[model samples]
Target: MDEETTEEIMYMTVLGCELAKPNPLRPGVNRSPSYFETLKQCCHLPIMQKEGFYRFLQLYNDSQVVVVDPESSADSIQLTKRVMYLELFKDLQVLCTQPDNVATRELGQRVAAELDVTYGEQVGVQYRKYNKTSDKTRLRFVTEGMLLQLIGDNPTMAGYSCLVLDFYEPTSNVDRLLPLLKKAIGLRCDIQVVILSTKYFEKFALYFDVPHGLTIGGTSFPVGVQHVTKVVADYCETACHTVNQIHQNESPGDILVFLATDIHVDRVVAKLRGAIPDMETFPLYGKLSKAEKAKALRSGDKSRCVITTNFAESSITVEGIVYVVGFNSIGTFNFLDPAKEEVYLRGIKDVNAMNLIDEVGIITPAGKVAATLPIDLTWYNAFNEAIKLGCLSELIDIAALASVKNPIFLRPHKTQHAADSPHGQFTAPLSDHMTELNTLHAYLRTKRNMSTQELATWCNETFLSSEALEEALVLQEDLIEWCKARLGVSEISVLTPDDKDYDVKIRKAITKGFFLHAAIRDDSDQPDQYRTLKEGSHVWIHPNSALGGGDWEWVVYHKIEPTGFQYMDRCTVIEPMWLLENDYFYPLPLTKDYGGKFWLKPLRAIIDAIDSSVPHRIGG
Candidate 1:
């Protein structure tokens, strides 16, 4: 073929080929140098040698790079390419090596000196290092607006440059800071972009779009290949079987598990630790304070396993991770459909599935075994088991839909009653003071029209602390506003706490908002005893609720419980179903007889009744 034809054929062929498949040149091998070399060679060709081709090569070289499938529709490809390119170029390098230590600190100081000379004194310099003693980390930088002031104050520093070095990737605040950095860089012509991390080359390559070079300083062998033979025997019985297979087959220091949530990481770690006591376990989640997360990343203990949520994906890099265990899940956001004038919690609707698939491999780097474990498969199996056991047809349908639509695996069955029961009852009794307090608040809101201060007085009279009442009110208002937004109600004119009936109104509001989480009073044997009803199926009122002081009531109706709380007990009242229904769970109509009076009605019927009576609007 002529050069033009060959170039055309290669370009067109690449457009259709899978970008995520095992390095093409190596075939069965996941990591092959030849594959990358071929990719670079292809990029150098006449037709392919362009800005676009350079981007493609950068992504190809970056072990953490996620290339949008060219076969994707033109619009999708364009959007994905833009986002991917922007991310790649945002940080030329991210240094993950610790900065508090002498060597790392000296490295930062040297880089800072170089930057000061290159960018001049107006540039900002910052350093972030973990303070192990205090269990905290600090970010000290020349603030953007103050950059000129610092330089003005000291004319001697006129030509000195600044460099911001973060020993670990700025995890918490930095994730929300990229846009600000973009703005700063755009506004200031003198600032330079430099990042330092142990895994900087791979991570920088994945997200960087500009001309760059990789320099490997220290020698480190890929760790723990022999440990692959000792895969945890208990396969994650979730829907995504890939995780289990990879965990079973992963070479030591080669696999990284990327979970969607910290809770999942904890659970997986616990399960794995139980199964393999000798294996070192590491968890990277937002909940861990920055110091803890940094320690987890830097410890570098051998035979170690790290389970993290998106932390290891692209923002930071850790060495020796060749295989990736991915839980294919996306975040949800509150969206308002303008045409319908309604608000709903929905999954990020237009997520690029190929990017998600690529994320797994990107974190592991090329020439590494990128194995995906099937955590979702376990969920699927559990859902199927629930269906066989006749738990709830609606739940079964929701599970089935989720299995098809989202990457989730149903948790395995715990116990017969625990699995079968929709809402688990509590065993504790409601305190006498709690009942009187609730009733008093309810009466004040309904009849007296009290203000928040008046209600606080009532709570004080009822023996609840003033501080506690204030905290409760704050949480109550937040929940009310959230509920209003969810229901798509624009106008909110509820009675103020100073009103005569404010107490009662607030109590009723709490009851209505958290109706699904109602708990039964623990009344042992005495049915007529007020607050002595059997702890049948009880959902604790959120501790932040005014009535959550342990007051229990047998509500005339109930609703589904909400999801997303971090520290909720299982078997608590069903979380308001609306939270999950709108975002995660799919509803299905079912016709089965529930044994209890409440169970007699279909789950949907009960939910509808609660929703309808709540006097709120629904969004499309």
Candidate 2:
């Protein structure tokens, strides 16, 4: 893989190839060796995981030196892998994020196909279960976060001579690992990194202080934007109504309806069927089967609708999309209510966090009051319970799953509950977090002997995303890996099977973590909405959440998402006195009395204490 391997072709005499009528080379024509055929065998090297495994291929660029003869040109060459997919790349490894990211895929595919000079190989893309690469592949395209794992494992990124961060976007993961990448680059000057993006970020200059940069204009056609005059209360029904109107009034072409989640996709599709029976509709997301994605991508239909999330906006391109119904009603916006939220979210300095917003204060939406935060409290309680129950690893896995937006199970359409019936086995009566734990435990046990194809089939049968399951497994593995590296645990024991108090311990953990984010079910209002303890904010559990269906009286959450309804997603049912009786949170009653209303407000002090310490993050 080193540049010194290949000797420069200084003066090569003509070496004509035998042909029927004419010799391939002229009398003075100079020719160099083609080592690409030999390079093909080493392409299968698992460069991401192993060390000192280099796949050398000088066929990428044959003519590096300024040859004396114009005829003596150097040989030229040119990739794939999903970061979580656990695939291998030959030479250069690219880390990308979007599963259906069209721009990055297009570039990778184009580069693969355009490398006419690279002997014995072409380019390919690796994401989810889709593997378009082979042993002959040189340029392997993977995701950025996955690339971080590879970097974390091998800080120097020694296997590959080059790294390309395609469609590079700013992220907390990138921010954390960029220093390691820069140090790697500095150590290995021969290692070339090409960062590609649609828009340039000047902030990147802080790490990559390059004087000249390349810019490429986008080749996409203009898309007309149409905004709604009045936002409808029922977005799905309104979206269905809009699609119907567009089909009836506007030009006849494919319509892309953007919804918040997969459930909304199914909901809108059902409404569309009733509104316009003739239209063929398909739900598009990362978790859907190939058949579904193909149906959505297929054109030539006079009129069709693909209900999807914002994934369609930049990731994949659906042909014949003449109209788009933009609706993000289910999507949550910001979560930083207190400076501590930013401190956790952005990994910001606690001192700087206070300056980012005004003085810390709680402004309740409704006059109603309660005891905890729906999401935070639940997680805290669960973590604490797990600790007491001796199931921290299991809790970490559950927490990691909850921390990500990806779903382990699919939410079937409103009319297709039968499809989602398999998830019933994993469902816990009171808490969705417990249900997720049940599912994870089952998956981990099943994964021991299951093949990828079988796993995918099992997921489909269970109304789950094999893609999401794959990502969840990655997250679970990361948590486990971090535990070993940070917490220094080789194997964490599971909760005792005979321990009856294990469940109680889990509940105690919830109360422990979320003394402040606790709440009581607002019986006067909706059962789904709750009045928070410290802040009087009336927040509803997100419909996509597993706990949403359960009517829990006292609930706790980690954070509240500031969206249409200010949803508390990761909620767990809690006992009211769990806050006051708890020693750590016992001082909450003395903090301040709000008209005799019992609630926790110890966040101001707890956050201040944590302000001096850096947040604990799973490296890589």
- Per-candidate Cα lDDT values, in order, are 0.34, 0.53
Number of the top TM-score candidate: 2
Q: Model 1, stretches more than 4 Å misplaced? A: 1-251, 314-319, 327-506, 512-620
After superposition on all CA atoms, what RMSD does each candidate show versus the true structure?
A: 20.4, 12.6
TM-score of each: 0.31, 0.62
Q: Which numbered prediction scores highest in lDDT against the true structure?
A: 2
Worst 10 residues of 2 by lDDT: 66-75
lDDT of 1 at 482: 38
